[model samples]
Target chain A: MINVKQEIINSIKEITVGHDIQEFIEEVLLSDLGIDSIKYVELLVSIEEKCDVEFDESDLGADALKSLGDLINLVNKTLEQKVS
Target chain B: MKQYEVKNVPRYFEPHVNDCFANAYATVLSYMGNNPNFILTDYLNFMYDEQTEHIGINFFFRATPTVEFSEEELNSSLELAYLPATSMFNKTSPIDEVTDKDKVQINMYIHEDQDIAFTRLKERIDENKPVIVAVDLFYMHFHRAYQREHGLHAIIVTGYDEEKRTLKIIDKYKLSSSDFDGEISMDEMSQSRLSECPLNNPMVGEYKREIRNLWMEIDIDPDFKMNVERIYSIILESCKRMKGQREVLGHECGLNRMEAFRKDLLLKKESFMDRKLDERETYLFKTYYNSAFKSISRSRMRFKVFLEESNLAEKEDLGEVLEQLENALKRWDICANLSLKLGIKKSIKLVDDIVRQLSSIIDIEGEIINKLTDISLTRDLVTVSKNIKDQEM
Candidate 1:
């Protein structure tokens, strides 16, 4: 009974400070949120550690991480695969 | 399949300074039993093109090609240098197929699945072939700082063992002292090869014969002189091209680009004061500064080597020119260190002083080049007269 979205939001908060979690929308670009290339990697590592899920090489490609929604969907998909 | 690794792969460190494409190409040549140094000198001779970009603040120098040397130039040089090597793969296409050439061939193989790519790579390694792979630096443990960023890098896979699930890789970075040779897990290797952030292009170079009697057919003295002329022309044109131009980030070339970089430091300082300096800008500043510093340092090193190897190091005027170049390089090092230690604000203050020093060095370099050109032309005339007299006799 893990709240995957909440877990992701919490992980994002820990990695990036000063961002209002409630205002985070699915359509907002990660770059607009000040998540640069290096910071984006850090966020991915943080989420992996918090969720205890390892992203596959295919999952980490450029096409997989376009926006907040994309990242959230990826985490959910990986979580589902883990449970199965 | 039997496990194997190629011996005497030329290890080129100084990743921050030397071009990785050149280093990887050198490694392949060394593995094929060729003198990497001689080949590198020959290749660098033809790589410079006199292209100028007018950025707003200053003219940027675009002297060298950002990509590898053209396939025709590279392949023909291999043949001319008597290396018994030929490249059959097309440069425009992605990893397609391996075509056999004389004694060695450059191969590219593309597979959508990571496992398939690893399988193909392992097949080559089993045959004692060292593969040159284009990988995203983010997945490499050695370059963790660049994680998730699509920084493409080249490395040689020398050996692999299925039982141990490890692959032997050679990476040269940070001066000759930091050459890397170790076993990374098969998983890491596969991920690096299959990274899609950057285009997934996996290339493996295979060499069979050891090159003996390493001789370059081109007349060393005249060719070297021509290279020197080319270098001087590029630098001189860059200096003159800076008139009434605004500084631009991506468009600046040569010394003009260096001046534009100084302007960037001042702008960065303003951004820092406003608390608007982000991680990306910081990363770009460091990259541009290092590249500018390394270009000058590498040029100085190349010329010094050329002079020493050609037995011209003892020339009184040329020796003085070398000393001037060394002093300029030292000042550049100091400027770089100062910028790193004291943030942008203090460093911006030193920019004008450093630019003036660099301009003076360029003027001195131009004078020395004029002297060298005179000497070269005189020697050529003397040789022509001797040849004519011999023919008449």
Candidate 2:
């Protein structure tokens, strides 16, 4: 299986399509990435599609997504759970 | 190729006021330089009716994102706020009955016939009136929603080329919010005007209205005079309105509605406190909360402008009011932003923060009302003094 970290990065790039903020540092706050409310919805949806795992829209990984690193970790944890 | 275009239309992006309808009106008003006061001050007046559940602003400060405003409601809202409700303007506010050539008329229409619509747009452009038309962003190439999302929006159509079948749009509504103005094919414009984007973007939420070639033709007389009495009365009405609830155009509105709304928000927060929230519930909650604060925040900012523009508020009075208003505006922005975050991530922290911010906003708004009341009483005293001095002389 592809590395879950790679999958999250790819999703980030995909969401940044047609957007100005293309490159981002992992330590950057997710807010600094210019992901507005609309983009936030799109990113969450994109991450769900990319990981091939449905994120609990309610609170599963949403609260966990304050930073880029958090998103990567959340996706990894989700993937690990899937494997188990 | 036949062409009709209105030249030098001002771009519509008023700071702290992104309401498409109001900005659209600003386009033509600024172009003529006719009624700066009307454009700035006298347009938006707060109206809250306790009889119903309508606690929002007048037509000019309204949009079609989370709410579908009816024609009657639109007219009545203006009438209650500060106007006698003119004809069919999709985006309108308080229309003052000014003297001389400084007359403003708004005519709204929903045409099923594209040809008829084109003819009307051309007719207005010929008179230098930049028409504000309702549109669905999905059909417009410039918008990110082109073929992606369907949400109702407004744009200014300034020109058209017959052979190319293109309309020049200055879509400055929420320019910071991913909306852009660009030329579009007549077919795209027509389709957008008559669109039914049932699956609208979840972010902006869905509206229960039809676009259907709906457009507003604004006829502003090139000479405008500030109606201080009218502006003063509207402010006075707001001072009375903030005290309690009253029915204005069938919507239960007032500053009191905000507390009730705040309580509702608290309930929603508690419901999602220790429980997994439903997706639709979250979306609806976010949409409803944002729409309210968006209008409320916008309305207060405009009120601040209105007060300053009227030249009625003394410098000291205006200073204190503006500072407090600006603070409250910032807090409303914070609350709205937090509400959206709460929608994304169910957090009691976000809820508590919004509740705290909103409570402060209410207090600041109360102080604003009292200050405005003092100004009004001062104005009345001056008016009576002038009359008595004239009699004594």
Candidate 3:
């Protein structure tokens, strides 16, 4: 029931200043947007704080989140485990 | 508008996102050789620099955004200070390493007229040669920094579509295996080139160069060998610089700079205590954190590969150095990750832990230098000091 997609968009909106919020589609590759590794970490931390989901070290490795869909999937999986 | 492209312009795989100039240079060389072996690691490119400026809120702590080697240090090197050259662009690269006599030489085309540069770029492409172009992505809509972040990034322009007014480009610097091999309108590319993009990076400190219509071309011999030995010399040169970090070019160098960095971070504990860093502060810390990680961890890995590639693989201390480097390399990653996390969390404990890690890295680097020096001396390798004397003579 948690709107993880909206939450992720909201985190992105929080980081993005000056520009109006563009629609961030799920299949969009984060790299295409030029999100470097450090910025990616900030985004992860922002999402963790907002969604109350902690990303494990395995999830934080360079290969972890490829696309917005992948991040959403990871967060949803973590959220699922939290309820269980 | 018309359409033209240099076919098979290569892409660089080892780009660390911020290293566009290096990537563009390598791509040109790789395209020249048409060899996968030419795609080498940038282990030789690292340099040491520490800032004299201090963090604003806490003037006691140095702003020290330079945990990694970058172009700023490259530009600061005394030998190449003969910049402000007879051209519209003053950017220099390590093309000398790969400058094969009668085989390869990098040439720059610059003009007071932006159209001249554009015409030159088109000429090279028409001749089936890819052109390396400098552009400020802020003015270019095809880039993420469009009207957002202002900085100069080198891109390889392969083709021009006259009717569509587009240019096919290869901008491979991306986040983790991501790349761009596509088209941008000529208007977009021209605008990017013409805009005066003051280098906005904290490390490079406001390099306000004319980005207008400057492009580079390299004439290559079909039988050119990839300069792997240049990498070997550069590797040794980098180590010698580390050994001589105390030689006083300016502010603190090598481990001494690291110590200052540690003390600063530790001192920032009270100011940064449990406070989430604002986005502006986060960006600065992020630059330092990411740069340090790439410069140390990735460079060491490539150095290990170099040892394996060279005759040094037979040496007794080879395995020892490799194993120790591997261990230290992991710690650099861990430290960098902690630093990244610290940007958000702002914890004092993390600062202490990073300092501990820094101390370990410094010790390891010192030992590695000693070991590498012994190896280089035994191998009769030419060192950086020798290179300087040779240059002077």
Candidate 4:
């Protein structure tokens, strides 16, 4: 099985470009990821690809996701379920 | 046919693969060849600089709505749509309630010549077993460059010759007009070349067989603001009408207007007159229509700027620029909408609360680009660092 943390880390690295993820996650909202909404959707799609799952349109609701941790948590939960 | 030349017409590029124009182009191209499967992409490393070039061509045809389709979940992550045509080569997958096996596909095809292609289509469609070929309109924008200035636009691809430097178009400019045909030289393409073309005439024949979508722009300037103004006025007027009705209804029942209005909404009585609001869905209707108008305005401006500044001779970076601008606009748009929604629904103050949210959109756009650049730079740095370490070893 693919390492879930490693997969998440790689995906985050791909988007973060070279910026310290630790800093971004701690300091920035998920919306500040420096990409457009389309890219954000792409990131979600990428996450789905990396984790092997799908995200629904409902996940895009305003209050649905508040921070990077929330998003990562959501991805982790989905990944865990997929693994199970 | 009158040979019209376009001087300094505007051009546009989709910032990403989901661009409306690219999707529309791809659909049309797919319809032509009877291939319903196409993947639109704007992730090309090359960028087409659109600010300085003008493409000129004349077209004669009309546009009809086409249905979009997607591949099934796994192996088919791509969404495809059929372009309007009279006949198709391949039978479309059965849609619910569409049981006609003899149904002519409404996709069109582009060919070496417009007159020949269109005549062939008309004749084939007349045979009742319509061929599933669609017309290509990628060249129509060039042919109809003049008409765009007048806000008269049509989409159809008739024909082209890279050697002869000519293109023919079929467009639907007037309601009464049928297939209008015309052509233009490739001089405009030469002028509007971006800074990143790896090959000469990279855009040439890109839409011949199939064109993928990369991004969509909704022009949101004067026209958009006006649309918002109009909708707000109408909705506000409706609110006033409701307020007045509430006052009357409440007076009759000895209740406050708000209370009466709320009660009337709750109580289904025959006394409720047919209000224009019967067709209204406040959030759904308002948001969608407003979004469309905004898109139109912003798209038009972007197109204008792109055409005005493009150069055809440079190894233009057509793809990257388009994607960048698209990223900028879309992110800003989302932030703007979110801010408005928060203000309206959450009663957030417009100044401190909303501006901060709205401004973040631009920041996000800037940062994303910066981040990408940063990532690229860091990758280079790492490569150099690895190279130096290897040399030392």
Candidate 5:
């Protein structure tokens, strides 16, 4: 199984520039990290690349991707689904 | 349910003025089997408010000196201008508070649930009704440039497929050839309906979709004479009110709006001449000038068509006024072309020449509008006499 937390952190880092990585925590809201709709798309694209899985519409529901920790959980779930 | 598409719906693009409501209304009327020319003429009547001001530019200045453009205010202005019930135009407004008592009905509905919206859309389409949906531009995959830009726009949903999960739409501002008749995934369409963006208000990061569904039912008036009289009265009132001060937006009508735009352009040109123009400044100047020119020119063309197609043209001396308006429009076109060239070449001489020509055209247009206004008032009196005669008989 892929390290979903590390992959998500790495993907977020790739999409966002000029931000302090140390400030990021699992509980931090994605909006607080400057993840707008466009940037959110970018983050998803980066994570999909690392996880080798594409996200369906249902997978990107607003409630499913509320926080950084939530996104990490989603990445792990999608990865598991892809393996199955 | 069987699928149906409204055949030969007349499509119009008023990109510079943002007349999506008019376009959508026209589509609805055409679908109801109304004469396209008559419908178009009615559309032109809606362009001018009761005070003869261009509805799009009738912005209310909320506070001193600072002009604020609110879409909500504009919608109210449009309603007042069209006088939907009398003008034979479809009544439309935001879904939350649509209380139009007009026989010709158009209403909007918002649904938070995508499935319900989709089912409702398909049901309407099956019944040969085209639904106008307001969506955030960012999530509409077909609009690539606007895919990242968050702005609320309305498009006609012509068809949908449950099996393919695709939606067929008609976008008036077809940026590319492929955009005119386009399709987007249902998922994307739903996301766009729910998507919130910062374009309208930066402070409010999410914009709730206010107009999700548009409902239209047309009841065309059979009395041509009555319709003509109503139109003439509206035009006459607009002309008379042109002189009155509007509390919102400094200008009352097209002539005043053009005057304001000309003065603003001249001031901007002078500042650019004083300093080297940067790329951003040049782009902004081009956009402002182009939009202003196109809006006036297109509206003038529609006004000409309205005059020609409607019974109002038969009024004595009205033809001459129409000719004068045409001449002014032609001169304005030349000035706009020169202005465009000057923007690119940055020639001070050209700037001065354009400003002079624009001022002259504005004067000519103002004179023509006043003449038309007077003529329409006289026509109104004649109509009143004719109506009285009919009643006495």
Candidate 6:
């Protein structure tokens, strides 16, 4: 079984699909990776499919996905809650 | 005003006519059952409702006629036969009073063998007179069936085209007079029977009546979000099956349909391998995949060119033109960036080329739209732009 940290990272990688993760993290959200509202929805959808978990809108807050660590932490908390 | 015969319809509405019949029938059902201004969800809901007593609804927008006909049939039903009902409604929004300063009259009895209503609608157009036609082709199809089913003799000649001799009249199911070799004979129409009344054979009349209700009653809600979830689900499901087949073979056999068809496929297959990738690695994959997919989808330059041609041909209102252009750019960016990330190099080039061409048209459309800004004009333009965009794809 994949851990929450790895799952979130995998989700991020899946979102990027081609390049290195750090480069994507720096360029995609901070600069313009062309992430519009629709694309964001698509990203969430892909994550949900890959992880087999539904993400609440609240969990998808802008601040929650600001950095790699924050995203990993959010996923861990969500997965822990799911397990409990 | 041109006249054409309707025959060789699909098995869906076999021996009836085109897909328009099914679409029209649905429209009628929707119209009869639901309140006006209902959204697409409401439209789907009305269709899903199973109650036989409830009216069925369906609708069609901007459909082209299929069959070809003669000048006589075209002239006889110009105003009453061949015009879009929406155009008439759009022109006279207050609903009631419409001027008939340029109306033409034709001698219906003059054609002994042909239908009077059909003849007049066709004949009038031969003289070059504009007509207000009903936009409900769905209505036309159902009404035609209803007439044949119910033996109804009455026919309403709805519209006609002066230039083409096309008559857009609704005899029973709102079928145009031109769709037939000879206008539906009133005597023949009257003799037709509905296997039994609604009180007797509910099934027979049910389909026809349900369709009729949709056209008359259903209202389309302006706000519609096209859900691509269903498409995505299908794609993902196919991917899953393919992956499952690959895992079962365990590198012993090669990829083929036989692997998937094997009876023990599920048992032999392995699960999606679990991997302990870090946060950064996961992010990279997701980003790349999303971008790649977008780029692949947006790479069609023909679609962009079609949109431009449609805009020019239709000369739709400017505000709408600008709005569509902006939406196109948004879509382009989403799809193009995704393609680049996906490692679909060909798709990236296609997306880039389309985006460049589209950008120029967007600028031109934007300028035109900005120069003219009236509420009415803007609304009309938006409608036109939306129609063009939907059809372009």
Q: Could you say which candidate leads in TM-score?
A: 2
**Which lDDT tens digits does candidate 3 get at residues B27-74?**
887787643222333322223333432321001122322212233333
DockQ-derived CAPRI band for the predicted complex in model 6: incorrect
By DockQ, is 3 or 4 better? 3
Candidate 3 lDDT over residue span A35-65, tens digit each:
5576677777888898887765435544567
State in Å the error of residue A60, model 1: 39
Name the regions of candidate 1 deviating beyond 4 angstroms.
A1-84, B10-17, B42-129, B142-150, B175-179, B198-286, B312-317, B338-343
Please, what are the lDDT tens digits per residue for candidate 6 over residues B133-156? 222222223343343333212223
Q: Mind giving the per-residue lDDT tens digits that candidate 2 earns over B1-393?
A: 688788878775775554666677677667766544344443233443333223355432233432234546544333112222224322244332332343455555665677777787887787777888888888878876788777777788898899988889888766335456667889888888878656543434455556667777655454545567766767776776676544555544456766776776677677777777666556554665556665667667777776666676476777898899888777776666666666755555667778888788778888888888798899899999999999999
Candidate 1 reference-contact recovery: 0.00
Cα lDDT, model 1, residue B103: 23
Worst-scoring 10-residue span by lDDT in model 6 chain B: B39-48
Sort the candidates on lDDT, descending order: 2, 3, 5, 1, 4, 6
Q: Which structure is stronger by lDDT: 2 or 6?
A: 2
Per residue, candidate 4 scores C-alpha lDDT tens digits across B1-393 of: 322222221122233223333433433434433221112211111111122111100010111122222212111111122223222222243321212222211232333343444344334333322222222232334333232221212233334454576644333232112234466444432222111111112112112112111111111112111122222232222223222321221122111222332233233222223432222222222233223323422432343233224332221433443455555455434433432342223322212322343244334334433433443445457769999999999
CA displacement after TM-score superposition, residue B303 of candidate 1 (Å): 2.9
Candidate 5 C-alpha lDDT tens digits along B241-294: 344423333434455655665676577677776677665454333334433444
**Chain B global fold similarity (TM-score) for predicted model 2 against the true chain B:** 0.83
Estimated TM-score per prediction? 0.52, 0.74, 0.68, 0.23, 0.60, 0.20
lDDT per prediction?
A: 0.49, 0.64, 0.61, 0.33, 0.54, 0.31
Output candidate 5 Cα RMSD.
18.0
Q: Evaluate residue A8 in candidate 6 and report its C-alpha lDDT on the 0 to 100 scale.
A: 49
State the fnat of candidate 3 relative to the true structure.
0.37
Candidate 2: Cα lDDT at B256: 74
Model 6's TM-score against the true structure: 0.20
For model 4, the docking class works out as: incorrect
**In CAPRI terms, where does candidate 5 land?**
incorrect
Highest DockQ: give the candidate number: 3
What DockQ number belongs to candidate 1?
Answer: 0.02
